[model samples]
Structures are given as structure tokens and as C-alpha cells.
Target chain A: MTTPLMIEARGVEKWYPNGFQALRGADLSVHQGEVVVIMGPSGSGKSTFIRTFNGLEDFQKGSIVVDGITLSDDVRQIDAIRREVGMVFQQFNLFPHLTVLENVALAPVLVRRRPKAEVQQQALELLDRVGIQHQAHKYPGQLSGGQQQRVAIARSLCMEPRIMLFDEPTSALDPEMVQEVLAVMQELARDGMTMVVVSHEVRFARQVASRVALMADGQVVEVAPPEQFFTAPGHERSRQFLSQIG
Target chain B: MSASPNLSHPQRTASPPRLHRLRRELFASPLDGLITIALVASLAAAATGFLHWATTQARWAVIQANSNLFAIGRYPIEQQWRLWLLVTLLAAATGLSWGLLRAWPRADRRGSAWPPNDTIAAALLTAISFYVPLALHAQAGIQMRWWAITALLLLVRAAAGRWGPLVPRQLRPLLALLWPVLYLIGMVLISGGLGLMPVPPAEWGGLLLTLVEASFAILLCFPLGVLLALGRRSALPLLRWGSVVYIEFIRGAPLITLLFLGQNILGFLLPGGLAPDRVWRAAWVLTFFAAAYVAEAVRSGLAALPPGQLEAARSLGLNLPQSLMHVVLPQALRVALPATVGQFITLLQDTTLLSLIGLLDLLGVARTVMANPAFLGRNAEVYLVLAILFWCCCAALGLGSRALEHRLNPNTVALNTSAHKA
Candidate 1:
């Protein structure tokens, strides 16, 4: 079996308006159904790099392709790329104004213009799958952190995305809530969804990730399977990051 | 369940007698207590004097004689049905639409904390200024119009209860999407149209004129405000700068100055030989003024949102328009309600200034009411009635905003109910 590339981001460079270089020649490639964990200290451009995949963040110079389409300045192409990519934010930004079912159903009904009844039916099912069907009628504000994050995941999944990007999804969770979110991610990985996750959960990476890509100062410092990357790092930067976390 | 952030509020408890609590609160120290007693005595004396004068000396003849002018001000009596019908339709549509949308929105029901003390005091003072003389039943025609309004409100309540639940949740956004169209139809109905006689806006007067001007400006300016807010935050410098200039310029100038321009100067801008009607001019100015304010309110609401919301919407494949209409606007409006309501109430009061421009607004017509030979020297009574009218309208706005806020804040309602039960 041959692996197909799902994302190819090369020579990515980004600078803030104030001349702060957040990304300098960052590069990474993700294959279909592969779980890539990007582990980095804070401010290493982990979030920025993932954001560029869905056009949430723009790079000054880069050729980033996702799901066979290359990123461009064209609105249509950006929209096209977004349809195939689902992103879960650290803040679990489930729309507070909408109930869990509505939040999950919003994209499909509004963007896809699918019939509301069908999407909402599927939403409740998705909620059931995430073990939060009981909370489906409730608003995001009424839910606990773990439940909100789960609902956020269900909301993203309702769009039927081909690829998922998790920007430190569990970072904002309380200690007890972290595993509940990770368990959902693990189940998604087992279902063979192509995923790029920027997280510091070393144990999660070792348990489920196909590859571990360590980033520093907006560039990929090392990439290897979790076992080799964690136990036998080839780069000093990778070793230093691992040691700091350890 | 009591997750209220207000840790300062004591638990709801059975307190001591009201007089005892009042004494403790107002007169904690001996000197303070003495002063409080003296003030209470003087206030009671003044109240007794006021009650005597109000019950015996004050003549409500001015109110009784000019009730028609105060309510509609010579709106061709036959054509008055148009206003009544418009009122019913607008109320029904708003009630139905809002009820449908109430299925979502976790709004704060703990009451919208009014922003400043001055506004409350001012509103209360104006309300108090007129209610004493205004309560007397003056005319059957005015009472019937009011009855029709109450009937319309009850109809809305019944309709929303029966049909609102039947509207599919997915179709609710479609209702929102259709607002501009519904609003246009409602405007044409009131402003005259298709088969109806074209009642020149010039003929709209008194409290009817005031309410129409303020309500239309509010309804129309909201969409404009949303657009302006988006433009203010747009990536294009042209749009962003244009919005900034428009908002700042309109906000920087006083509302009356803008009204003056709308009344006199706007006619010059229109094509020669066909000056725009007075009502349209006033409305245009009021809409612009209110839009600028609504834009700023919406901007703050937009700003209060975390960047994650937009990002989340976009990442789900929802395009700019879809994201804005569904995700962004709903949340923004939730935060912006109080500010929007404040602008609306202020615009309502400012409409009285149209009287200064020779329009027969409530205040303007009240002056006409006083000029009548029988009502001469009854200036205090007429003005007091006018104040009561304006105050009632403003109070309705406050109550509506609170209801909308409560409907939106389901979590707060949940907490409130559960806490009470506990």
C-alpha cells in the first residue's frame, strides 16, 4: 500500500506587520490517515503552521497544498480548501448562542445548504457517538469544558471533513477533562482520519501518532515515528525540547 | 447551580421589616438618622401638598380636549386604519420571528443592568413628570386605538404560542434571512402602496409620527449598522476608512443638527422640482444617526468576540457570508443588545426634535394643543402628558430589550430557576 500526501507545506515564511518573524522557512508533509503530532515549546509557530492549512493564518511565502489543492489568494480556492479541512481550536469555540445540536448542524445547513432536518438528525447521532446526546439540547455555555470540547469536535465532524487539524485541542482543558478529549481524538485516529495535531501530550503521541514532528522558531526541527523521535532524537533542538518536557 | 458571578449579593433571605431596613440603610448614624427624619417629613409634606393640588387645582381639560391631536394629530380619520393594520402586522411578525429564534441563544436573563444612573433617573423623572395628569381617560377614540394595540399584542402572544413551535429550527434562519424583505413590505404598507392611498409622510404626526420615525430608523439602521461594523473591520482600507469616517462624523455631530440638515439641506441634494417629503428626510437623518451608533455598538460586540469564533466558522468550510449571518452576527447581537436598545430609546426621544423643524411631532402637537383658547395657560398639563407618552414608549423599549436578553440567555435562566428551586 502506498501513502498519499494529504498536506504539503513548503518554504513557509510569515512575518507580523511589526516585523516579527513568526515562521521562517517552515516545512512539513502529512499523508492521508496519518496522525502527526507537532510538539514544540510555546511560541514555536505550532499554532500558526496548523492555521495556515485552513487559511486562518497567512504566510508571506509558501506553497501549502491540502487535500490535492494548493493554497492561493483566490477566495474560491480558500473556500474549497476549508470545506475539506476541519479544525478544532484550543478554546472549544462552540457558538455560545446556539445549542449543541444547532452548533453541530450550523455548517452543513448554512454552508452546504443541506436540509435542516437531515443535518440535525445527523447532529444528534453525532452527539450520541461522542457520548453527549443528553447535552445536545443544551447551549455550549451550559456545558463543562470537556463536554464543550467534545461538542466542538462533533460540530467539526458534522461538516464531513476529509482532514482534521487540532491546534492543541486539550491544552485548555482541566487535568481531569484532558483525557476525555484525547480519548475522542484517539477514536478518530483509529477510524483513519488524516490529522495534524499540535500538542505536548507525549503519551498521546506515543500511543496513537504515526509520526512526531517537532517544531522550533517556526520551522520543523525533526520528524520521525513517535517511538524513534522520543527515544532517539537526531537533532539537538528536538532533544532539548524532549528533555525540557520530560 | 448558583454560579452567579455576583458574590457580593447576599443569599435571598427573609429580611426585617421594610421600615426597619429603610431606617438602617438611610440612617445608620445619629446625625444621619436625624437628617433622614427631617427629609422624610419635608418630602411627606410636599407630597401631601402635591396630592391636594393635583386632585383639586390641576385641570385635565387640556388633555381631554386635545386627546385626538396627541394620539394622531389630524391623520385623516379614515386613513388611520392603515396605521392600525401596520401596527398589528409589525407586532405579529416581530413576535413570531423572535419566538422562533428563541429556540436557541443562551442569553442572560438576570436583567440587563442599565449602564448609567443618569439615564434611569432621567427616564424616571420624565415618567413621573407626566403620569399624574396623563392617566385621566380623555376620549373613546384614543382608548379604542390603545385597545387595538393591546389586542394586537395578545394576538401575537397567541399566534407565537400556536405557530412558533411549528416553525422548523433550520427554517428559523430563513426567517431572519427574510427580515429585510418583511421590513420593506411593512414599510410600504404603512407608507402606502399597491392599492392603498399614498398617505404623504407629511401627514403622519403626533405620537404616531414619533413612533414611526424612531421605529423605522431603528429597524432599517440595524442592517446598515451591521454592514458598517463589518466595513469598519474590513481588510480593504477604502471600506474600513470610509466606515470610520462615516461613523465618527455622524457620531461627532448632534442628532438635532443632523435633523436640521435632513429637513432643510437634504431637499437641495435631491433632484430639482421634486423635494423629498419631510417624513422621509427626518427618517433618513434619524436612520443615519442611529446607524452610526448601532455600528459602534455592533463593533464593540464584534470586538468582544474571540478570534476563535471566526476561525472556527471558517475552518468548518462556511464562507464569509454564511459565517457572518449564522455564527458571528448571532453572538455579536447577543452582546450588543443593551447598547442597541439604548440607541433606539435615545432616537425615540430625539424624534420630538422634529417638532422644532415645524413637523407636528408629539411635542409639536402638544404646543398646538396649548394654543387652543380653552387650553390656554395649560402648558404644564400638555407638556406633562407629552413627557408621559415619551416615557411610556422608552419604557416599552427597555422591557423589550430585557425580554430579548432573557430569551437569548437560556443558561442564566436555567441557573436562576435551579438556584431558586434549591
Candidate 2:
């Protein structure tokens, strides 16, 4: 059975003013409930491509349709796209001044103008879902790397986003802590949440991903099912990346 | 001590005795000891001579006699209660506002800072603060009034500490309305026409005029500075250029030149009998000058912020205004605290320049007191008193800003790591 497309991007191109090309004709697509993991060497532009989906990074040339909101120069459209999309950063970019519950509840209450009590209740439930309900009152600094990343995931889930983007969320975690973040993501995928994750976690990609896409030198080099991609990646760059990371 | 755990932290130890450490650090070598002893002897000799002169020789009676003039200038003595009332209101306000922020970071050197909760300590500070005026034999009214303001400040602080942060979102409009409430109060206090005798702006002088000018300038200048900073960072060319031009133009001119223009030239610009008072004129000049420097300081703070703050706020679906209010400015203001506080202190001192235009602020009153034949030949006493007043006010502002900085951001606030993937 074919699933409906949740995201479709075509010929995405971006360049810095200083003349460094960060993305060159990168294309990405995700179907509803698909867990697509993009892996690449550093500077391969996988993170930049993911950021473009929500209009955080402007593209010089591209068409991205996420949840039917096209990325464009229009402010209202971009804001709509951002609301429908939730992003988790590698740094776990939680607001330091606010408590974990506030971090989760802030975007919905402030952006969506939802009822405070309702948003807070939902946030508490999200925290529990992420396995950090006990840390609802604690600030981000008080949490370990794994717990903080989990809180970030819950914060995104609080928005009830149609598409979730993870920009190397576990890249900043301790080796021992990486498993906990991946476990949460695995649970999220099991719930059929459409997610695009840019991470170097090979085991997570192999186990949880619907497809593993390899990017090299600012372009998508190959896209294949996880089992096939892990065993037989098409591109020379993908083989090199796999060997180097191993 | 016998079976300590393998902890990561260093072991604590009792510090060396002060005398032993001092001798080792300062008197280790014979030449070092000889030089240290000589330096100490010279400092003690100078301090003793200064104390002797201060205690007996200086005629502090000049300041004593003109204490009322120093406190409220030429305003009627009976009506001085209005100024005293203003002080009480402002002190209470300071306490309430101070209570809104959370406690200061634990890393502060003085331990727990002077928050509103520390009312007894505030009362003690108030009592101690009055000693300068009391030691010089100021009127009991002025001294008592100072203590009253300080005590009230502490009381309001405690009250605010209890319930200010607890003010629910529905009552936020009440808090928002406070700015207008304060404006109305200030206007009534200064102009005094609501069933009270009107004190002309010309009669406003001494600490009254200094505090009024600096406070209004600080209050008005901060919003203006924030606007200019936002405008300078705005994407629109018109707003950015307008802010840039205004900031550059005001910063180019000396504050004295701006004051001169406010006093001498602004009157010509206004229609006959419609000109604002010199006090208002000086206020405008000070506000404009301060806003420019404050804008620069705030811009530096904005620059210091990592780009991720904006990105994060934007990604969270916050528009520009919401992004700025909820995320960017909160952090930027903490970064801008010291520089903005520095500008405020400078503006306080620069209020002295208002005296050049015949506005009788603290310095102006001191000058007038010196000019009087009765107080002639005692310039030292008047100037010294004025210096002390200015120094105390500036110090208070610096301390307040430092406490606010520690409370708002602390060292843990800035989590903007340059490395995204690491």
C-alpha cells in the first residue's frame, strides 16, 4: 500500500554570500509515516537540506512542499510551514531560562494561542511520553545530555507537528547517552510520526529508518532501503563515509 | 580524611592566617619589606593628616545651613513633603520591580544580594545611607525622610517578593498599566496642581532636579534606545538608515552642546509663550544623548548573541515582535546591562551640565550656594557635598544593574554553542 507524500523537495540550491556553495540541487522526499535518515560526512549539506524544509535557511532555487505548505519568500506561508514542522537541534536548543514544561508548552501557547491549562496538560503528557515527566519543573541545564535531548523531542511533539526534523540530535550526546535519544526516536517512528533525521547513528538508521539516503559534497548521492543501503550503497562517497565512520 | 572517595573536585583546606599570608606575600625580601613598610607609613601619615583636617578644620556649617536648599532648592519648606512623598513612592516602586526577577546567581561574591526580601537589611542600609547627611548635620526632616524612603523600599520589596511574580497573566494588564500610573504620579509630584500649590520648574533644584532629570531621562531613554536598536537591526532600509543617522548624529555632538541647543535654540523654535521649561529642555537633551549611547550598547549586545537564538525563535513560529520580546531582547538586555548602566550613570553625572543653562540641579544649587555671600569662602564644603551625592547615586545604579544582570542571565544563560554538530 502506497502512503501519501508528506514532504517533496526538488533542486534545492543555496550559496553563502562569501561564495561557498552549501547545497547544490539536493532533492528529498518523504511519505506519510516515513522515517528517512540522511547520513553524510561533515559539510555534506544534509543538515542544511533539512533546515530548508521549514524555511530556517532560504534557498536560492528550490521547491519544498511540506504538509502542503510550499516554502517561499512569503512570510505567512513560512510561518505556517514552521508551525506544522517541529525541529530538534543537535545542541538540544532548549530555553535555559524556562523549565522543561515551559519549554514544551511555550510554542503552542504563544504561537498557537492555545489555552494555558490545556497546553500545559498536553506538555506534561508529552514529557511523560518522552520519559522525562519527573523533570518538568527542572531547567534545561539541570538535565543530563540524554534527558535534555528527550525533553527537546517532547517540546517538538507538544506542537503536534505533521513533520518532525532532527538535525543531528544525538551528535552532541555522550556515547552512553546516545542510546536513550535514539530509543525515543525509535518510539516516535513506531507511532508512525513522519520524521527526517540527520544523524550519524548507523545502528539507528539501520533499525528504525524506512530508507537511508547518503549525501556527498552538497548533493544527494543515493537513496535506498536501509537493508540494501547498509549492505550495498551505490556511490563511492557512501562507501568511503561508511568506512571512515566505522 | 583517612578514606576519602575518589572525587573529581579538589580537597578543601583551611586558609592560612591573614598575618602569615601577608608577611609571606608582602614582606618576603628585605628590600620588599623595607619598601612595603615605607609605603604603609606614608599612606597612614597621609590618612591621619586627612582625617585631622576633615574632623576639625573644614567648616561643614555651610552645608548644614543650606541643607534644605541642597535637598529641595527654593521650593517652600512646608511643601517639601511632596518631594518626600515622591521618594517614598519611587522607593516602593523600586522594591516591587526588583521582586519580579528571580534570585541572583549563587556565584555572586557577596552571597545573597540585596533583594526585596531582605527588609531588615534594607532598613539597616537605609539607616547607614543617611549617615552622610546626618554626619554633616542635615535637618532631621531630610535625614528622617531618607530613612523613611529606604524603609518603605525594603517593605515594598518584601511585599513584591511575596506576590509580584505570582501576578497571574490576567493581572498582567494591571502591571502593564503601571507605566502610565507612574507617569501620572510623577507629573503630579513635580508640577503639583492637583489641590496642591504649584511649584514652578524654576524652583526645582538640588537633588530634586538631579533625580528628576536623570530618572525621566533614564526611563524615556531606555525605550527610545531599544527602539533605535531594533530599528538599526531591522531589515527595512528606511528604519535602519533613520536609526543609524540619528545615533551617529547625537553621538557626534557633545552633551554640553546638546544642552546648550535645548536651552538656547529650542525656545526660538517654539511659538511665543509655548516653549517648554528649561527643566524639560534639559530632560530632552539628556534623553536624546543617552538614547544614542544606549542604542550602541544594545546593538553590541544584539551582535554578541549567537544567530541560533533568532533561528530557534523563528523556527518555533514566533514572528519578529514575538521573537524579540520572548527570546532575543531578554538575553540581549542582560548582555547590554553593564553598558546601559554605564550610560545611565554618565547621564546622572551629566545632569550637572544642566546647571550651565541656569537649571539649579544639585551642582547648580551648590554653585548658587557658593555664590551667596553668606556661604561664600566655603566652596570646598558645598562641592564636596555635591560630589558625595552624585557618587552615591551613581554607585546605587551600578549595584542595581549588577544584581539585575546576575538575576536575569547568570553565567548559565548563554547556551549558544558555535559548533552545531559537536
Candidate 3:
């Protein structure tokens, strides 16, 4: 339990301009190589909470520290934090204009200013790891949804971040194609990559998640290991959530 | 294996013959046939009369006599060689750029055949257009030889296309560098700066002046428009409101008013009665006017993008500029292409407004030519040539933009072909 902390969130709060609160006093911490899964019903702020880790979503109140860099209003700090944290969204937001290889190779070459040849080689290897190396030349639109998601993963992996965040990554995917994306995530987890995933995939949670955090009403309600969380629920809401899903 | 009919070999539904299709479309009902016949008769009658007038009655001597004035305005006759040299350089640069652009690996891989047939056709059409005009009017000796040399320079583009791959990858950036250098050279040659005899902007006229104005306006306004659009969407209120105010204020006024303001009042507005050249003032005014529209066009493009694209870019550690340059603008600009090109064509036509303020642009030159007592009532001939010139330029802009849209959206092209097959 004494591994280095990769992410630390304290009392994170966010509100839309219409005064609807999305994240309220949310707090969580993840150690290096730990896999944390945030699960909740629709509109429970699980997605909102995870998005804050990478500075993709701004919080009106609260502080998030990723890999020792604190997230603030300073763009430079946000950029630095984002450099160490990778995120995957439900929509798979791959750049449709660029080829799959270019998608993976772009950030490293652009943001990191890495040598193109070296970054491309690393990109091709990452694409291979995700089992879409053959689709490297194709645009994102040309690939299957599953393949596009894998390329998105490869694109994130190419940055070689200290932490990875997945916000309902498989929610938009077709049921038949879900397993392929999950398999890549599972492989990623096994490689000891610190990940914070917000998904309803119970099987993925059971298999790879080190801790499952239940969120409701813009806050994290419970955090426990999957074995304990699934078997015996301390909170009444957790039991209610489990039974409803079943 | 069970005996079954192969679905792949299903009977094809052959389309009806072209003649039958045409007959059904045009003559389906008695009313349709009657309407079609009436329309065709009127069109043919009008066209025939127009053709007869154009061939026999139209006096083209005004256009012939004033071709130089139309092309270069009052640009000195001795300094005309500079114009010819500029044309030769332009021809070579355009040819080489086109070749190198087509030779670029990403553009090449998008399945267009090398030396695209349509491009060749466009080139031939352009060549014939230039040839017909010059052959009909240009004084034969030096002008014809310069024409020949310009045509020969254009052939360099084809040769470069054929062998562009042999160009070293490291040296390809020089192709990009060539443009700004050429632009500077053109400025120097035309305006006669840096050790050459200076030509005042007042002396600059005709198509040359119109082109210079339009080019400066278009080039300057694009980046300004992009910045303004970004500013309108900025997180900071000051930047956002400032952009909104500027865009609205400029958009509210008509361009002619802006030009007039530039011509008469702009000099006084400057400190110490410092007046810029009329051409500069007109160009700046046009740039400001066009920029507002371009900003709106680009804003629409920015609006159409999903927020997820920006989020993903930021999540990748790309700063705002990097994200915009690499991801956001490329897609947004593609979406904005048609509208932006439309604005550019409008701006180009808007240059004729320069004539209203005493600048002798293409349209102005035509008016001056018509004013000549020798060519006193050749309005039809003069106006028709002017219309043709404007039409050619606008049509080329439209066609070029479409080609660019196609090249940018390779995925769309692939999807279209697949859809067509389906």
C-alpha cells in the first residue's frame, strides 16, 4: 500500500453555468500501478470526477495533483499535468483527418518534440500491442469502432503517461465489439499502468480493478477492493446499486 | 455442399438507355413537353441573336487597342519587361509548386493517379484561354515570345511532377519557402523598390492592381480572421467581447462605405497627417471588411467541431496553439473551405470598388477605354470582356476550392466511392 501516489484529489467540486453541480466534494487517491474503477448510475458524476484528473474538466473548488504537478488555472501547469496523464473518452475522439499511425505519433512529435523517426517506431510498436498495426495507414473513419478505440488507446499510450483515465470507454461501443477494447485495457492493466476507469463493465472491474469506487449525487460514496466491494457492501446505497444492476 | 444460387451473381438491374431516360424525363406529360419546347425555343432564339451580334456587329477593336491598359494600366511601357519577367517567374513557381504538392507522399497515397487527367484538362483550358486572348490582340514579336517563354516555364511543372519524387525530402521545405520569396520579388519588381526605379501606387492600374489588392487583402485577412474567430470563442471576456464588437461593427457597414472612408478620412485619422498610398488604404479597408466575414466563416467551422476533439487534444498535453494547428484548425478549415472561398471570390470582385475611388482597376480601365472617342459606343464589347474576365477568375476560385476540399477529405472520398458501389 506504500507505493508512490500517482494522483491525489481532494474535495473536487464543479458546476455548469446553469448551476447544476456535476462534481461535489469528490475525493480519491491512486498509488502507482493501481487500477481504480469508478462506477455509478447515469448522471452520478463518475465521468465528471474522472475527467478532472487530467484537467479536461475544470473544478470550481478542489485541487488535483497528478504525478506531483498540481492542477491550477495556470495553463502551463495544466499542460504539464496533462502531459503525465492520458485520457480516453466514450466517443473514442480519434482525429479523423490523420492516419492511425499519425494519430499515435502526433502528440509525442508535437508536444514532446521527440524525433519523428523514433516516435513513429514507438507508435508502430504501440499499435502492434493494441493489435491494429495493420490499420496504421487507415484513417479513423475507415476502422471499425472497436479498432478505432484501440487506436485511441495506442495514441494515449504513445505519450507514455504516468496515469491513464478511461471515462466510459466501452459505453458507446457495440456489445459484440466491447470485448476487444476491454482486452486491450486488461493488457494495459497487467503491464502495471496506473489507470482510473469509469465504466459499467462489472467483469472488467472484477478482473483488473484494484479498487472500485462507487459514486452517486456528485460524490464518491464508497471505495473498496472489488472482492470486498462486490461480496459485502458496507453502504446501503452500494447494495441498492448492485441489486438494481442485477 | 447444398446447391444454392450465389447472391454475388444475382441478375444486374441494367439502367434504361440514355435516350429513353431523357425522353421520359423531358416528355413525360404533354404539359412537360410543351413547357420544355417553349423554353428551348426561347433559349435558342436568344442565343442565336446574341451569337450573330457577337460575331458580326460587335466592335472588338476597343478591347484590342486597350489590352495593355487593361492588363497593366499606366505601368510604364519601358518597365513592361518587369511585368513579363514576373509572369515568367509566376508560371514557373506555380508549375513547380503544383508538381511538388502532388508529389507530396500523403497527397499521392490518396489514390489519385499521378498527373490527374482533370488537372491536365484544367491546365489546357487555362492555356487556351491565355493563348486565345493574347493571339487575338498581343503585338507579335516580343509579347508572343514572352508568351512562348511563359508557356515553356509552365512545362517545368509537368517535368517536376514526373520527377518530383526524386527531390530530396530535406529539400522539400524549400518548395514552401519559394512562395514568400516569389511574393517579395513580385512586390519589388512591380513597386520598384530596393535599387529599382520606384513606381507610385497611383501609376499602378488594371488587372495588376486589382490582383495585388485582392491578394494582399486575402492573405492578410485570413490569419486575422482565424485569430478573431478564436478570440470570439476565447475563455477571457475581454478577448471574446473585443472580437464580438469588432466583428459586429465591421459587418454592420457596407464595404463601399469602408473604402470611401479609407480614401477620404483615413489620412486625417492618422497622426501628423500621414497618408498612406491610396492602394494601401484601399487594400487595408478591403482586408478589414473581408476579415469580418472570414471570421464568421471560420467561427462557423469552429462551432461545428465536437468539444471532445479539443478535450482529447488537451488531454494529450498539446497546448492551445499545437492542438489548434495540428488537430482543430485542419478539420475546422476543411469545413470552412467553401464559405471561406466564397468570401474570397466576393473580396476579389469587391476590388472593382477601387475604381469608384479613382483607382483604375480592370473595371475602371474598361470604363476609360469606352470613354475614348475612337471607341465611343462599344459598351457591349467592353462590358462583355470584363464580365468574362471576372467570371473566369471566380470560376477558377470555385473549382480550386472544390479540389482542395476533396484533397483534404480523403476519408470522405473513400466513403463516397464505397457508397457509390453500394
Candidate 4:
């Protein structure tokens, strides 16, 4: 690929204090505009691995470089990396006290020290893009689950992040509401936003992903295009996981 | 199971008659009937006896004669106008706050009705309860005229609620800024600072002293408590440990002992034996003591918040302070509001302990009045008045906190229920 690398991680390792190892030397690299989806069983550490990309989770030993800025123990570097990376969670954790527009506009105004009027205008545009412009003045609690998730997406997009991480973004949605969020993610992918998603939706992976990575026991065991990963299994664990889910 | 006809449309089933409901509740069985009758008889007897005593036996002469002492203990008579001016300022501020609050648009689209019936009723009830006794017993002269003027100012400002929206948007910020300025002005007027005749803290007493001490303590302790709460949760070990130690030490000691120590030992502990006034010492002690409790309250609030909220804020590039100030604390403080206000009320009541340390708060002045040979053996009247005053203040605080909680959480059931009704 001629595109520049957006994220690079080498030998990431994380261990909880209770002696449980969540991640053990996991490595993945994504070029700009590439969509990488990590699929695994519950304990395979897919969530933990992506969380480390934005410095949300601490790793015992690993080096991560995002958008040419290396993630280190330094607070300033962590903050800088966070500013460049945006994350969406399964629960759609919007600030319940603030209006939908305020939730999207808050970080830019507070963290970026941008003018309120400019940020709010941008926030409204993002909300419109997510198809919830009418619900902008309402609090998060007043919105439907799908609407709230879409607002969450708009909130992340307002930062104009170079890399977006999704940790089971649709896993918390109702079965009927999943497609609305998936549709938004698909749109994001088509727009050439670099994305890392951890989800169980094989259809999303098959449709939107540039490459699919399989995780097993705290490590990425296989990385391949969706057609190859789904139709022809390279690893025994991958074959077993597909059969179990099916 | 077959569906009953009433179950299919419960609302269509007419409620049982009130007489039948009453009978079912009070006389379902022989024993129930006897118990109800016995309880009713006892309640009636107690009520009648209290009414008889209140109407005929209780002498309010002591309260009537010492109203000035109760309002502003030992404040020189010449400076009494300053107290009246303070009252007028407070009345106007209260009205303006109420008007502005009502004028602010709610998120739920329900318009704030002007001259809200319940609020007006409450104000009238409070005025009647306090004013009736004073009118019947006390001489109606300068004090009464000042009271009328205070009430007039309050009415005028509250009427401004209807026009609060008409206030220019540019001037609204100034309106918000006016509060702290007014508070400072109040302090200066009370203490006679900035070219006015200075009044010593020793001369401050009665409800005036109690209120001054409580207000200052509440204002100062709230931020201190929030900081201490955050410090307790800090990743830095020193700050966490220091907060833990302070909270524990203060919570471990009794308030009375702290008050005594503040009055006696705090002077020696300060550099160059710089003893502040006794009132100042008492107020500081109350502030520090209440802050420990407030910290615990706020900590509970912080604990109730989901871990995801902080993570979301951080992922948006907010540093710890920005994340906390914008997202975490607003939600946590809302959760902590009831308990924090509870601490404030307790702190206000705790100021009564200042009397024990030689400062004459409301309780202290009451004791002084009871000891006067002219008002000998009027303990019931004196104590009753004091209890009523304290109750009024505490109840007002409770109401204010409830209003604040409603304002902060428009998503709460309180607003939802109103919306449902609408």
C-alpha cells in the first residue's frame, strides 16, 4: 500500500494484578484509510488490545506509535495520542447531563480550547451527518438506544480524529437496532476513515473490512482479507471459532 | 387463569366510595377498629391539649420584648439601620434570584408559570407565621416599617420575574456576577468595613451571628470539600494519603471538642500567636468539620458514576481536570447535592455550639433572655421561638436543595412525571 501507516504496535503485553494475562505480545499495523476488524472469542483480548491504541488501557510492555507520535509513559504524549484517536464504546457513554449538541461540542471547546460558536456549528453538522439533527437539543436519556449510539458516533467524529476505534459498538444495541449503527460504520468506512473495530458481526467484517484479524488467547493468530478469512481458514482455531458461532 | 372484566380495563372500574374505603382501612376487624379508635382518641387529646396551652397558657412577652436582641444581639442601636439595609438587600436578591430562575427556560418545554401558586402560598404562610406573633405582641414602629420596606423590595424584584426575559443578553452575565458582589457587600455592611464604623466580632450575636457564621462556613467549605474528595481519589499517593488523614482526624474528633480547641489552641498554633476573633475561629472550625463530611458525601457521588464516563471524557482528549470539571463533577455533584445540603444544615445547627464557647448565637441569646429577671421562668416561650426559627431556616435549606436538584437533572423522574401530566 502506498498510504502512510496510521497505527503500529509491536509486542503489546498486559497483565492484571490478579495474575490474569489479558494481552500477550499482540501486534497489528494499519495504513491510513484502512479498516481492520478484530474478531475473537470473549476472552481473546480483542477489546484490551484496541484499548491500548488510545492509551485507555495500560500495557506492561509494548511500544505503540500512532500517526507518527509514539505512546510512552509521559502524560503529554498520552494526551497528544488521545487527541488524535477517538473511541466509541458499546454502551454509548454520552454525558447524560449535557444536551446532545453539548456532548459533541464539549471536548473541542474544553480540550482543544476552540471557540464555542465554531465548535457548536461543527457539532451540529456532525449531528446532521449522523442523522440525528432534530434530537440535538435533547439529553441522551431522551433518545432511543440507536439514536444515542449514533450521537456517540457524532461526538467522536467532531474531533476529526485520524483513527477511530470501535469496541463492540453494536454489541449493546437491540437486534433490530444493530443495522442502524452498522450502517453508520459502513458509511464511515466508505468515506476512507481509518478504523479498528472489535465486533462479532461477520456480515460487517465481510462487507466493510479491508482485512480481518483473528485473536486467540491474547494474541492475533491470523490476519487476512475477509473473503480469505471467512471462506478458507488458515488456522485451526479460526475454523473452530467460525463453526462454534455458526 | 381467566381474565377478569375489571382487569381488562382497570381505569373503567369506579373506585370504591370514600366511606367504604375508610371503613375497610379502619375497621377491617374488631381489633383493627379498636386500635384505630384508640389512636384517634389519643391524637385528638394531644392536639387539643397543645392547642389549649398554645392559645392561653404560653406567655410570649419575653419574645416580644427581646425581638431586637434575637435579631441582632448586642449590635449598637445606632447601627441598627445597617441591619435593616442588609435585610432590604437580601430581600431584593432573593426576589431577583427567584425571578431569574423562573425565567430560565427548562429543557422539557414546559413553561414556568408566573407567580407559581405553591411558592406564593409558601411565602405567605411563612410571613403570616412569623409576622402574626410579632404584630400581636411587639410595638409596631421603626422595626415594623423596615420590615414593610423589605417586603416591598422583595415583591418588586419578584415581579421582575415576568420581565426577566426582557433583560438584555449582554447584561445577563452581569446579573450572575452580581451575587458574589452582593455577598461581599453584605459582609462589609455587617462587619462595618471599608470606612464604616467597625463592629467587633465579639459584639455580633443572635440570629445575625448564627447566619453570618453559617453562610461563610457553607460557602468556604463546599469547594474545600470537593477538592478534598478529589484528592482522596488522586493517583498521587501524597495527596490521597493527606486527604485521608485529614478527613479521618476531623471525623474522629467530636465537634464540641473541635470548637473548644479552635477557640483556645488555634491561636497558639498560628504564627506569632495571631489569634483571630472567637467568631472567626468558630466559623473556621465549623467549616473544616463540615468539609470532612461533605468530602465523604462527594466521594459517594463519585463512586456512583460509571467508569465509562471518565474513559469517554479522556478519549475525547480531555485532561484529568478538564474531564472532571466538564463531565465527572457535574454528574457527581448532582448525586451529592442532598447529602451536601444535609451537611450544610447540620453545620448551621452546629453554630449553636458557639454559645458554649462564649459567642452569643441565637441559642446563646435565648439563654441570656431566659436568665433576665424581667423574663423569668419563660423557658417554654423562649425555647419554642428558638426551635421555630431553626426549623424555618433548615426547612428553607431543604427546599432550596430540592429546587437545585430539579434544575440540575431535568431528566429525573420529577421532570418526567410533570411531562407525563402535561
Chain A TM-score by candidate, in order: 0.98, 0.98, 0.98, 0.98
In order of appearance, the predictions have TM-scores of 0.85, 0.87, 0.93, 0.94
The order by descending DockQ is 4, 3, 1, 2
Give the CA lDDT, 0 to 100, for residue B342 in model 3: 99
What is the model-wide C-alpha lDDT for candidate 4?
Answer: 0.88
lDDT of 1: 0.82
Best by TM-score: 4
lDDT scores of the candidates, listed in order: 0.82, 0.83, 0.87, 0.88
Q: How many residue pairs clash in each candidate?
A: 7, 0, 0, 0
Distance (Å) between predicted and true CA of B357, model 3? 0.7
Model 4, range A82-121, lDDT digits (tens) per residue? 8889999999999999999999999998888899999999
lDDT per residue for candidate 1 within B30-106, as digits (tens), equals: 89988989999999999998788768988987887667678778778788777667666766676565444433333
lDDT of 1 at A7: 96
Q: Tens-digit lDDT track for model 2 on A1-246?
A: 298888999988999788899999998889999999999999999999999999888889878898987888999999999988989999887876667888898889999999999999999998998899897877787789999999989988888889899999998998999998899999999999999999998899999999999998889999999998888888898889888987
Q: Name the runs in model 2 displaced over 4 angstroms.
A: B1-32, B91-183, B264-275, B410-422
Question: Ten-residue segment with the worst summed lDDT in candidate 1 chain B?
Answer: B106-115
Please state the interface RMSD for every predicted structure, separated by commas. 2.3, 2.8, 1.3, 0.9
TM-score of 1: 0.85
Superposed model 3: Cα runs more than 4 Å off: B1-20, B105-135, B146-150, B268-275, B413-422
Off by over 4 Å in 4: B1-33, B119-130, B133-136, B268-275, B413-422
